[model samples]
Target: MAEGDAGSDQRQNEEIEAMAAIYGEEWCVIDDCAKIFCIRISDDIDDPKWTLCLQVMLPNEYPGTAPPIYQLNAPWLQGQERADLSNSLEEIYIQNIGESILYLWVEKIRDVLIQKSQMTEPGPDVKKKTEEEDIECEDDLILACQPENPVKALDFDVSENRTIEIEELPPIDHGIPITDRRSTFQAHLAPVVCPKQVKMVLAKLYENKKIASATHNIYAYRIYCEDKQTFLQDCEDDGETAAGGRLLHLMEILNVKNVMVVVSRWYGGILLGPDRFKHINNCARNILVEKNYTSSPEESSKTLGKNKKCSWSDGLSENPGVSICSYVLK
Candidate 1:
């Protein structure tokens, strides 16, 4: 054979090897109605509070045949969807909940990809899918989640590689400084760090400082001392997301205003499971402890209290993410 023919043969071998690594050994195509092809959730998955996602595609030699697929493999899917992953795999199909979810997913992707290819008068490299769909009404469709590939795909596995459990939300702070009412609290108010009545008293000083403690996480949050009439008026309107009602309820129960506390957390990967919670509580508690809250004797203090708040930022934005919460004190 000529040198050119040998060089072409070598390139073809390299291409086949690369495809095999990605799609695995056995590859197939879709025949009839859409079915599942494969399913894959992240190896980094954790909880309902957070989850992961992924995508699958068909091999180049697709329809005349259909596309391949993939989806999440979970107990809920097996119990709820009554799915058959193997069947989808056999038919080059995909689904979401289980095996079927995988089949639909892969075929959907393949259909769209191929449809785009067949366009005779392809306009720009970046054509809107809708514009393409208007013309090429083919048999398969892209996934509902198809638009956002490279979006936040999750890896559910929590083994040493992925995210480990940190503190759950609604952190507890055992260390709160207490003193005889005479020295501070000149405003004749209650001090609470919740979604309610009290806030951090920036104006007052415990040891002649800016009434601040480096220990608190949700630093300087406060509630106003408004009565029922004003409660509905000047105070912040309640919100389900921002949790005004919860804060207000706490303030009403405490009967104080204009002070808040901070809460912080450290990720403590599954320490038998209990350790993460314990570590979070301890971390917050340590702040209070550093401020001489827990270890201080009752006789040394006029009063004692605990405050809880979470700082879950919105996963995708500047907002805090999910912070599940509950609190208890003695």
Candidate 2:
């Protein structure tokens, strides 16, 4: 190897070892050869109210000319908050262009979380609520001791209580449908910047008779929040068990933000076993790649080779080429 490559390798090793020592169990290596790793960070080490996982993939030219690609995983994070955090990371990379900056990035996120937690301190209102709950508990205990009057159970009809009407639907992109053992799976993609848009997409998709009739509609979405410097994301199984989680993991792996993907499965009364999940993920990945949410294998290799610089414009961009993934239980 050339001298520059050797130096870069050494620096990477040192940084990895140092981070492991500092973070201990929270630091984990995902792919040693590919230089991919993840670290769990929290606002407070002993008593954490909010936490997130940061995954980073170091390119070969890292610490010399390239920045380590990264992603933040936090389901509660959303909107302008995620955008602001990502932009800050890009700015840090720009400011420290030829140095190992993993520690800097970790601390920056931690600091932000701390600040957020401080702003929402538990005060008199919280104390009052706790006291009220205690009084309710005491009253319930007293009632339990008295058998003079039998307690009557109350029933409520909740079928339409939580309905959210869809006012409009965003444009959706459909991937080529997949079929196996008489089962059909087709993935739908849409751009969403908030929870409201996410709900709208689902409502609109259900308006289509074919989609509504499907056996399962596993979906996942991620939206960046600028104010909180986090992401707001969620997934639903729709009776597919762990299928929703798997779809969400695929989107995370692609580093897809401000977007949602739904895979509708029409079961053909034939048992596919593990093959069902394979077909589901395949449909999702195909649509994500087709929609440019993630790069194809050929493009990924090329991206790694180039010394991609994040300019001011890049800081404002939502996609930064960082990715992570999750698993399905069903």
Candidate 3:
């Protein structure tokens, strides 16, 4: 590389590093490949529909190959511009680095740049709100995904004849179990409060509380993520179990601290055996970890929390330092 080219390349590397620190693992997907940075400008900024941002990263192959492609979902890139860009990418040969790749790269980049250049501007706070809140921030238009209004999956109800019906779907709830609880030894999780620890925190907080208790053949617990109004059904349990330690062990693996997982086991006529209890608890814990409630709460409280959105690591610099995702479920 020429001296000047080397100097520019080095400069770009340094800048990407800074971004990586700010964005962490997620940064790799958007930051430099050949050292070119594209500023993601969201054209709209008021009440966004989904998270929107400009993604700048060089395609795997470059230079003599195709130039880096622009992931322009900017507020302005919607509508016709979006369609055109979408069509352009459908060209099979243009997918990766290859002969005259730079031409195609620059060509697409040019198209996007021209479109973006003409787009409107977002407010000064767009950057702070979107990345910090994990909400989409736009330059001139708003494209965010608030939990209160998430992008729903296509609405379709199952039928014997199978005719798709598009309409509102009801929230899922397994409902209270119907059975007897006489000899049933009910083990309840105390109300546990954890900042980041997902499993133990919530359950620990609700451990001693008898507020939500019942006797039946079914056992159930909730997984509280950062977002309360979402994925509430991620928790799991069986109506019967002889031992609940397996559930306790699974909690250890997740290092989840804040939210609670309340497992209320009911008595069943026939015992499923002790091994079954371990397996059942294990299953429940896995469901909680998989459900991923840590960030869920943060997301739900996004607009409500005002300005407290932050990564798990951010806690280190602040009052409570980040630690091993530890688990201590009682």
Which one wins on TM-score? 2
For candidate 2, the lDDT comes to 0.65
Reference-based TM-score of each model: 0.17, 0.42, 0.21
Q: Candidate 3: which stretches are off by over 4 Å? A: 1-244, 293-330
1 or 2, greater by TM-score: 2
Question: Each candidate's lDDT (Cα)?
Answer: 0.26, 0.65, 0.33
| Candidate 2 local lDDT, 38-149, one digit each (tens) | 9988877766777878899887888777778788888866898888888777766665556556766787788888888898762111111122211111121111112232
Candidate 1, residue 293: how far the Cα is off, in Å: 4.3
Candidate 1 vs candidate 3, TM-score winner:
3
- C-alpha lDDT (0 to 100) for residue 119 of candidate 1: 49
Root-mean-square deviation of Cα positions for candidate 1 versus the true structure, in angstroms: 28.9
| Native-structure RMSD, model 2 | 23.9
Instruction: Judge candidate 1 against the unseen true structure and give its global Cα lDDT, from 0 to 1.
Output: 0.26
Q: What tens-digit string does per-residue lDDT give for candidate 3 at 1-330? A: 676456434433333333332233334343234444544323333332223344544433332233444455445456875666555543422332122222232234444554454664432344334444232222221112122332222222222242223212212111121122222232223222232223322222223233124332223222334564221222333343322223432332233333344444433455545433433343344334445532332232232222222333233111222222211111
**Prediction RMSDs, each to the true structure:** 28.9, 23.9, 22.6
How many pairs of residues collide in each model? Answer: 66, 18, 61
Q: C-alpha displacement of 67 in model 3, angstroms?
A: 50
Sliding window of 10 residues with minimal summed lDDT for model 1: 179-188
Q: Sorted on lDDT, highest at the top, how do the candidates line up?
A: 2, 3, 1
